[model samples]
Target: MERTLVMGILNITPDSFADGGKFFSFENAIERAKEMISEGVDIIDVGGESTRPGAARVTEQEEIERVVPVVTELVSIGANVSIDTMRSKTAEAAIGAGAKYVNDVSGGLADEKMAKLISRNPNVQYVCMHWRGHSNQMQLKAEYEDVVKDVKKELDERVAQLLKSKVSSDQIILELA
Candidate 1:
């Protein structure tokens, strides 16, 4: 049986579910990533935007500022970094800074350009999470006749879109939220 790899969270926002903005500074963030690495984390998920239940969305540029430099630093130290974002701009910049993966919580709902970005880079890994709207309004939009099936269908369609755009199966990670 294949064992599950532990993913350590490196949240940089002030409203993340648990450890919000507590890890916001670059120096503190780098130290935490290093700690996670030493703790046997297989992937260090660096998030700039807070996706906690009632969190507000940050500007695209702010998200980039919060995550890119950390990704570059992690890359320099050989850390397997995955950026948590749905903004194509942020993902594009993060990938350029050496983020090995993209963790998009909205699964493409937040931005259509995200799928296009994924298609362009078949080598970078992707994690598409189940989501309906922005965190601030997501709670208001969670109603579904059959939540499981609806979420699955949404994910399938997104995956199909990526495949149609030429993103190979090997480069994507469909996150089941």
Candidate 2:
């Protein structure tokens, strides 16, 4: 049987769905990453934005500032890190800071540059999730003839775009969550 790799979640924002405000501080976030590493986590997903319903949108600069430091610190400590963000700028900063992956919940809908960015960074893994829109109004946009078929179709289209942009299949990680 194939072993399932564990990816630890590190929310550095004050309004995440769960564990918000728990590791909002840089020091706290680092500690949590360390703990996860010690507990055998294969990857650490660091997020700076809160995508809950009605959550406020953070500026790109704010997201960059909130995540780069933590990502840098985590990578320095030898933890495999992934940046949980949708914006290309944020993903670039995180990759520059040593993150190995981009976990974009918007599936590239939120940022036009995302697919191209992932394509450019051929070594970085890209996690594209099933998303209709941003969290603030995604639920309202969830209409579909067949949920399963529609989601697969959407993801396939996004994947095709990524491929056209030169992203390798090995570097793409589809996220159903």
Candidate 3:
């Protein structure tokens, strides 16, 4: 078994639930990433949009502003950065800025271009999370006949789509949250 990996959450925006911008500055973000490295974080999940309950939607430009710089700096320092976003534009920009992974909580629902980003980057890893809609209204529609089974089913379909898009199956990881 690969064992449980500890992934550090880095919210670069100003509205994240717990530690939003508390570490958003480029210097502080880099320092915090280093701290996570010291504490043994396998992946540094970098999020520009806040998906917290009741969080507002962040635009693509704003998201890019929050994520890219941090990603480039983190990569320069040798940290494994995972860009947490749903928009394909944001994903492409982030990966270009040195992120090696895409952590989309929407699971390809919110943005249609997500699959394309994965398709174009064969070496990039993908983390797909279960999502119904934007956080502004996602919770009201949380109804699953078979929670676990449905989660697996949805994840399987996402994996299939990625495969069809030319994304290697080994590069995809399903997140059941």
TM-scores for all candidates: the values are: 0.94, 0.96, 0.93
- Which candidate, 2 or 3, would have the higher TM-score against the true structure? 2
* Candidate 2 global lDDT: 0.91
Off by over 4 Å in 2: none
Q: All candidates' lDDT scores?
A: 0.87, 0.91, 0.86
lDDT tens digits by residue: candidate 3, 1-177: 689977899888777787856976777877888999999998899998899887898889998998899999888888889999989999999899888899999888888778888888988998888777788887887899999898888888877877887778788888889
Q: Write the per-residue lDDT of candidate 2 for residues 122-164, one digit (tens) a residue.
A: 8999999988878789779878899889989889998998888
Ranking by TM-score: 2, 1, 3
lDDT of 2 at 177: 62
Please give the distance, in angstroms, between residue 105's alpha carbon in candidate 2 and its true position after superposition.
Answer: 0.5
Q: Model 1 clash pairs?
A: 13-21, 14-21
Best by TM-score: 2
Question: Which pairs of residues have clashing backbones in candidate 2?
Answer: none
Candidate 1 residues lying further than 4 Å off, grouped into runs, are: none
Distance (Å) between predicted and true CA of 72, model 3?
Answer: 0.7
> What lDDT tens digits, residue by residue, belong to model 1 across residues 98-153?
88889999887788888789878877988978778887888899898998899899
